[model samples]
Target: MRTLTLGTPRLTAGLDQHHRVDHTAHRELHGPLPQLGADDLITLAGLGSLRGRGGAGFPFARKVRAVQTSVLRRDSTARVVVNGTEGEPGSVKDRMLLTRAPHLVLDGAELAARALGSPEVVIGVADEGARAADPVLDSLRSAVDERGSGTVFRVVRMPDRFVSGQAGALVQGINGRVPLPPGTPRRTSESGVAGLPTLLSNAETYAQLAVLAIGGADRYAQEGCASQPGTVLLSVSGDTVVETAAGTRLSRLLSACGLSSARAVLVGGYHGAWLSGEEMSRARLSRDGMSEVGGTLGAGIVLPVTGDTCPLGETARVLRYLARESSGQCGPCVRGMPALADSFVRLLSGEGSPEDVLVAAGIGEGKGACAHPDGSAVFARSALRVFSEDLSTHSLTGGCSRPVKGELPLPDGYDTPAHPRLLVDWSRCDGHGLCAELLPGLVQLDRNGFPEEPDIPVPGPLEGDAELSVRMCPALALRIRAPEPGSAR
Candidate 1:
């Protein structure tokens, strides 16, 4: 396979040489990883101004210092975790780093472990089809056996869901629990995995760390822009992988990718904003640069939306996937996501009101345990604003005069509609009458103050109120159950 690339190569320097880098090849391409004290790591990271490759864009130096300080305060060893779980459907830089350069990532993990005085390192991979991550798992095992590194490396498979890759959820999974974000958000660096202070970062961040350690700060800074130094791996259109300097212009990248013209572009993944062709042409590929234009280089994804595809229809499909992927732990996410998705679908079909879409999108923000709700909300809001003319056409006349070519990529199994049924646990019910009061339309009080749900599945119209009632239930007895896959809807 040919690797399409631009700018300086550090982490993916020698991927063209081999499928998987063995210990020997790893040592050859990048020499021995330098051992660093905690202070040294912070210094190098600060000098390079390295940001987390994950969606958060947190400073790497601050994160390292946080873990070190936390471990010292607790008087315990810190556990280092490499988050290789590329859960974002539109991103694949993490998987590529793991698959082609697992050893480089391990080298960074080992460095972090040494700096934190830890004995173990955990590499978490997304458990999707398993076929995509199999090579990385095999390479990890091979590296462990061949290198005989003193540090204990464990490979854990994370849940394939979007929110499962969150640092807290990944830690929970590593601790042998279902990979879901805790209701009360906690910093994994403060307390994680067997209650030890943990240092966790994205896979590409670790690979970059390895590069910084081996190549030294001065050499690393030679590449990329002043604000952000070093190279970034981008998964363009889910097919072509490009390694470019941080400040490369989006227009230049697109030109290199052979797209002469485009209607619009999505900087970042699904959570990121949409930019017009002119705006994107002027925007830079770096995080800071993209931010200037109300966009983000989140998860290293840059997908162009060609004029032929209907942006509204593509957006509706994505919203549908996001709605289906909701963790169901949060009421707003469970309810608001479906409402937003269904509303978008209706709006696309020229049947729904734009006000309902706006309301659902507004309600979804900041109401969940994680960023899923907020991200989806941002995506929807951006879509509505970016495609205003299209919305006008659909709303006024009920037609855009264009067919949806499905330009945006939606993964398999997420396209199916969610047929949800509400289930109430009689044992936990105390009959405070709040659920019935909140959603009188969906829940009716029986003789014994028990709630009686309708015989049919909860209709989409009542979903918002139903979820609110579920959330407000004093006994936590209410829950929504989705139909099993391939089961009768």
Candidate 2:
């Protein structure tokens, strides 16, 4: 990944010369880490109006204050968690920080631990295995050794699924449980990671904090807009990571990355909303700016698609991937998401109405265990709005006659499983027993005639039957898919 800077660099100060900045080099570039107490750090964050860069854009000061309050009330020591799990496929800023600027992230994490009176600091990266060869895990481990700070830092691997980066889910993964969000919502500041008050934020957020600490609030506030101070990192088109001031024009950043124009830009990641070229040209890279453009700087992902590809087709592909990536713990996500994806696919094929997509998108709004459903809804709705021209073409003429270029990227092992399996989309399935009859060895029908197992891996001998069943399903709900990224084959 190439790193570029628009203005003066803070978190990415020394990255131009060094691939990975070590502790000694980091100190030389940024100067020594300043010692600050809990109140001081919180005050500094408030002065800069720092907010978490992990998509939510919550005020960092409020989170620290809430954790401190919980610590005192519970009479418990807090735990500091640095969430480095950048599960959004289009996002790589956090991973880049963890790999190329490990010390900066560690410095911020250590400062938070010291302020919160916590001895344990946990850094959660996506599960690339426990092997020391992993770049992110290795860089963090080496940095911890070099710092030799009094506080203990433990780097743990988290599931690399899309929703695994949720604050609650990250905490749960650090606790060694399944890295999925809890059914009932709970605040990490109150009880997290072994039921202790936790100060958890994304990797970039902590790196930004370290930048704040080194430069003080005044210097940090000098670069970006008054509302949002300091530089923000953006993962653009999955190839370039740019560190630019908060209010930098979106068009300028795209030009810097060699993208002069586009039909639509996906501001944020898959769960984020889409923006037409006009909106993209007028947009800024801040929270308020993105809101004005009817989007969010979700995980700082900026992806643009030119007119060569069908925008609706691209959106449908992403929606389908998002539907498959659901945690499958709630009705809204498991059932509603597939329906949403189906609606989009049908629209893309000119076999469904726009109302179908709208209704399906609303099925999961405000109703999932996590924000996946709502965010997916936002993405779908925005696509419908931004790509209305493309929608009309597809609806009237059976398509725009343009192919899906797959401009939006999915992770390598994303739907491509090592083993092929039979999967069902419950939203379209109507107690169909045709699959069960065709592939009795691989599928079984329950009393309701629905497949007893929604998902089943196809054996080598049963591949033929699986194919026949998939082709013969009356509702067109059965499909043969490879194992998803985190699923067991």
Candidate 3:
């Protein structure tokens, strides 16, 4: 990823020339990490009004205080987690920090550990497997060894799935469990990672802390908006990571990325809302600014939708991907997501109404174990509103002239060639023959009137029928699982 800056770069200062700033270079560039106690760190954070660069924008000082309280009350050591799991396909700022400027992130993490009196700092990066090794992890490991700091640092690989970056999921993965949020919500500050008070924040948040520690509150607040001082890292259109002071206009960032025009801009990632051209002009690249324009600077993703592509079609593709990416631990993932994806697809093809899309978008709004459902709903609804004209054309006469140009990015192999296979949740099957009747060619009823050859891959011609079978099943036992890498077809 390329790096750009709108103003004097702090986090990205030395990144322009250096491929990876080693410990020696890092020290020279930013000076040594300053020692700070818990109270001192909290004071600086409060002064800066620092918030998690992660999607939530939670107050950093509040999180620090929470972890401190938990530690004092339980008499337990706190763990500092540097969440570099940039799972949102639209964002790469965390990865940039880890790969290009690893020491900055480490300095921040180490500083936090020292202040909190924590013995260990855990940094989580996406596990990309053998196909592509994450250099970020390697850089982090090397940076830790180079520092030779007293603080113990462990760099661990996490699943690259979208929801795996959630605080609970990250803690769960570090604890050797599946990296999915627990069914019941729990605060990581209160009890996280080995049942101890944990201070977990996005990687950039930690880097910002290091910046604050080095520059002090006054210098840190010199740039950016007064409300939220300091610079923010944005993954502009998934191609460039730009570090700019807070409250920069959205148009300036887009122009800096060489984007001259766009029909609309998808602020934040898939979970974020879309701003129309008009709204985009007025949008500011800050938390409050985004909210004022009915958007969020979620994870600092800014993607523009140019006129060359059909926005509705692009949204349908993303909705389908989000539906597939769900953790499958809640009703939203198991049913609502697929239904919403199907509705959007139909809408894109001009076979379904906008009402269908709206209703499907609301299926599991506040009922999921995580915010995935709510975020997906927000994304879908924003698309409907921003692309109302294109939606109207599609609803009236099928799709528009433009084809589905994939301006938005997904991970490698996201478009894997695989057929949809029928999966039967036997617990809910109840031996209903509705599936077999709906997909006569793809599914067959056995002696018990349950689906036979449930593992069979539906033929391309019958994939539609297979989906229909799933939707029509009275028991809601049938689902279509997309083919995985080594799954039997």
Candidate 4:
């Protein structure tokens, strides 16, 4: 494939030191990954502690086995994709590997590609900084060029949108479709990238693949806890102030980036939880580890929150932004999130109700199309849990009164959520009759005016989004929102 290299985060971000694979040597070692016998790969992965890098930290063996079995039963060419779209706001590990150690990342992708029948290995990238995409591209090119053996493929530079980093959305974008997440269930390993049985994983996961290739399972298992082995990259931006041992419980880790002097840490992404005080301090960065703390190791992203701002207000702003980021494919996410956002806003403004809190927590606690709903719900729940003190404070007095510091990241929340209740943007809209006519239960029309929607809950399907309402709207003002969370699978 490409001239491989291994080991990254040259800066040694966290407290732990990662023993990464040497991509160059890793390339030489790829002499056919010894066709792992049944459960052998999973055992090896488990031994190596091959936790998924996509933040969720699902065991590689779990996904590997799932994809392996799925492909074995189906008679189709299995495919693979290295999702390099690192879109979480506070996290920067995947692109970090790409920019500095492209070969390592590519070598990882190649190693997995080889083990999995050398299926189409498409490395996709769309980093936060324009500068980020180049390094990975250069590295992938070099690795492919060096192999001359022909197996590696091209690196696709994706458009840098928030959800474009999602595995399904990324696959859809690569296959020449809108870069939005899908609603109905579609597994990447089952049907991904051109309707092929594909094995799509995050960029860091690929790099880890290369590492596992060269290190073998034993070398991979050397570090980290037993439940799940390996060192995980964590962005400590969640904490803004340095926490002392007494005030913080920082994981004595291989790499705790940005944790030098922190307050709280956003354990997950935007949809992640905000753990403050000892909660942030004591937390570790691993699937098994984060799980122990009621937080997840999703996408390997963590933001440490310091005293620079009020955690409550910061979370509120982030909630609003996440609401907008909803693909608008499900109702729970499209509308429910906005409502929750408003609740958070009201709380921040000292104009909230206890009922608001209870309702926000209950609405989609169970029903929704995707994990976006769950993710948002988790964020809301965790926010309430941690910031409850703030809410109580606000209730006692007028409000936190702290300015809604935009410090909480709403990476794309600003541009999307201005739909203005029912106002339509005609030029951008073509009445497919979807908004008004599609789901008459959810929407209706004014006596002598435009279309209108009732307060009915939206159905999960896009048609429920009311294609007729969209078709009928002279201006495409109505957007269908899917209320679901995204899984690494």
Candidate 5:
């Protein structure tokens, strides 16, 4: 949990001041966080126009209202779930909050529980490989005994997949299921986590709530812009974490990070848009400000692209990652993403048809159960728009005339997606056609009575029958090879 402060630190107030993780340090540095009733909290959030720190940027007050209303209508105790799964490859601010100021986040979570009458609070951190790496988990364990609030605290490590951070996915994961978004649209605020009305939000949202609670609405609004008055934590590459006021100009941030010479910037994380150097100079760091320049403050990641590398090639690598991280739930996300990546690959290799990339992007928009496909579309479309010259060079001569330096920050050690395929060990086969008989839709028999493999990965619906077929195979020749590490099985 490295830290950097460009302006005043609101969420990270005590980190640089006290620099301690234990209870005494937290209390002595920032004092106790104020407890507010549900109505007061809602009012404070509405006055500040607080938005979720997660990519969605939905209104925090509205979410609180919905959860409160649902719990009232159902006459049940609501559960508060804190989502600390920072799955965005380029963002680490959430990890910073979790490690440096665990109590601040817990303060926010406890306050929410008191407001909603929720006795239980669950904090979902990712597995050890990703954001839930040792530093954060250790901080959380140490903070547990220091909690003075009466609310029960439970910490669960989520799966380290990209979509596992989605509200629905986190809810599903907490309930002992695979952390994937559900097929239908069911709001977590209404029905979540074992059929209880749940108040769920990302890690940074809770941290902001803590700041508002401790400092009051007037003090909280003193720093940021008029539209959204608050501070935001930004992950500017893995090297530095910047905390600045909302509505700060992108150019100012670039200058502060020694990136004034950058030609273009990848605003937000991978799912975010790209801004040209000219557009970036006028862009603001706030939500409305980013939208004015055709971008959003998604995950608050601002990565500058210098002129030294091939922009098209860099975008192509991120597209490949986006394609691999798909949940395989919808047609557009499963097929369209790979097609988009392939088009970029061909363009980088000098054989691309320009229309294929845009066409694939269009096909993927709004076609997934989750926002994964739509985000991929946004990234692809923005790359095409912002890197037109690079695209032109690649399309014409199959090369951008510049070396690929891998400037864009991609997830470390992200394995390629391998679609689940039927594999046969021929030595163990006895020419049995049982596998073909059990799942005739996927398997076909060869002339020698051996099962002929299907070309595509097995669909999720057929997994039951496929597993049954594997078990029923008399000669043990048929089996399904699991998909690659980052792929959806």
Candidate 6:
């Protein structure tokens, strides 16, 4: 990767070797700064839809307004937390900034702290690799040593689980509470860290803020799209991994990094969607334009689904992994994800029928505490839209017979248990087989009498005796899927 790229196109120009915190370009996080005048930050954010790098794609304006409002209104103490914790796999942009450009992220955090009258600033990060975390922390320490009275900013080590970085969970952990989101829509802006109004955002988002603080709006807007005038960092991975001999040139590397040519791009990490490896038609990468095509800017990690990889099978495996990642906090998500995974696995094997698709969409829809389930559903549904030809072949053949080559996704290991399904207490199961009757494609019956669903996606369109068999089962073990992401029509 290019260690120092400046004034380039996309969200990466400001990035140094470090992904999350790039302090090399900025001066210090400060001993303190002038309190932010109302509306100063709103302008500093470029007064545009500069989207947050975090997958939520929240507007920077809204965040500024929230902090701006809190500053203008609330009386108690307020704080800022630069959330460097990346719970999602395939995400390393933040780590890059933290390890290499620590100063920049700290500057942004410090700016927010000073602007919002937040005396305290906490940088929360959890690393998947030990080696990556220390450099980031050390860089942070140096920034602090240069400014703070040795105490203005703090870096907190968060729990390693994927669930830890969640806003509510992060608040809970900092406060010595459990690291889990509350069941309600309680805002972190209301309570954070330890009972203080907090302005918290992903590490990369803060890094962008620092970039804006120093570079000014004109420099930042130079190469970006008119809508989202900024560059982004993407972690590019390709099939047929190539390690060059000592003589590999920079240009060849850039091409491989996806600066040239067209291929399926996995944006926003795993929760992102796949784009057709169309022509270089997609000349630049940004937010709104990608969404117009059913994709997101994501967390800025772009993994290429190269030609050699079977996009279908790879998508199937990712769906399954994301399904398991569900926190199981909500009834729809916990129950629906497994069903969605099963439906895709079936489609991969060519066993999925028409009825299966409908139910999978139903189960995986808006049922989760967060948008994870809905996002995964969007991924699956879009994959079906893009790969209808593949689906047709699988339907005709009764199975893809492709051996599920492990491409298009990182290895999640083999033998992971199939996510659990809704079960019927046979004692409660009235033999009415309501479940089998309701979702016949999903649930069948064994000899003795119980719903038996193949651990795969049930294709849409089922009928006849097999359908009748499930219909007879009264126990309703056969709940259909939720409406699924982006599938209301």
Highest TM-score against the true fold, candidate: 3
Per-model TM-score, in order, reads 0.87, 0.86, 0.87, 0.76, 0.86, 0.75
What stretches of model 5 exceed 4 Å from their correct place?
Answer: 130-133, 415-489
The residue-by-residue lDDT of candidate 4 on 95-180, one tens digit each, is 56665445556666655565666456887788436363465566556656655674657577676666677777888888888777
Pitting candidate 1 against candidate 5, the one with the higher TM-score is 1
Clashes (backbone N, CA, C under 3 Å), per candidate, total 0, 1, 0, 82, 1, 63
Model 5, residue 382: distance off in Å is 0.2
- Compared to the true structure, candidate 4 yields what TM-score? 0.76
* Candidate 6 to native Cα RMSD, angstroms: 8.9
**Candidate 4: stretches off by over 4 Å:** 1-40, 127-133, 238-261, 410-419, 423-435, 438-489
Clashes of 6: 63
TM-score of candidate 6 on Cα atoms, chains taken together = 0.75
Tens-digit lDDT string for candidate 5 (244-332):
99988988888888889998999888889999988998999999999999998898888878899888878887887777677666666
For candidate 1, the 10 contiguous residues with the lowest summed lDDT are 453-462
Model 2 alpha-carbon miss at residue 482, Å: 9.9
Question: In candidate 6, how many Å is residue 316 off?
Answer: 1.9
Task: Tell me how far the alpha carbon of residue 157 in candidate 2 is from the true structure, in angstroms, after superposition.
Answer: 0.6
Residue pairs with backbone atoms closer than 3 Å in model 2 (clashes): 417-483
Q: Which 10 consecutive positions of candidate 4 have the poorest summed lDDT?
A: 239-248
Clash number for candidate 2? 1
Comparing candidate 4 with candidate 5, which one achieves the higher lDDT?
5
Using TM-score as the yardstick, the better of models 5 and 6 is 5
lDDT of 2 at 26: 93
Q: Model 1 misses residue 5 by how many Å?
A: 1.5
Q: Regarding lDDT, does 3 or 4 come out ahead?
A: 3
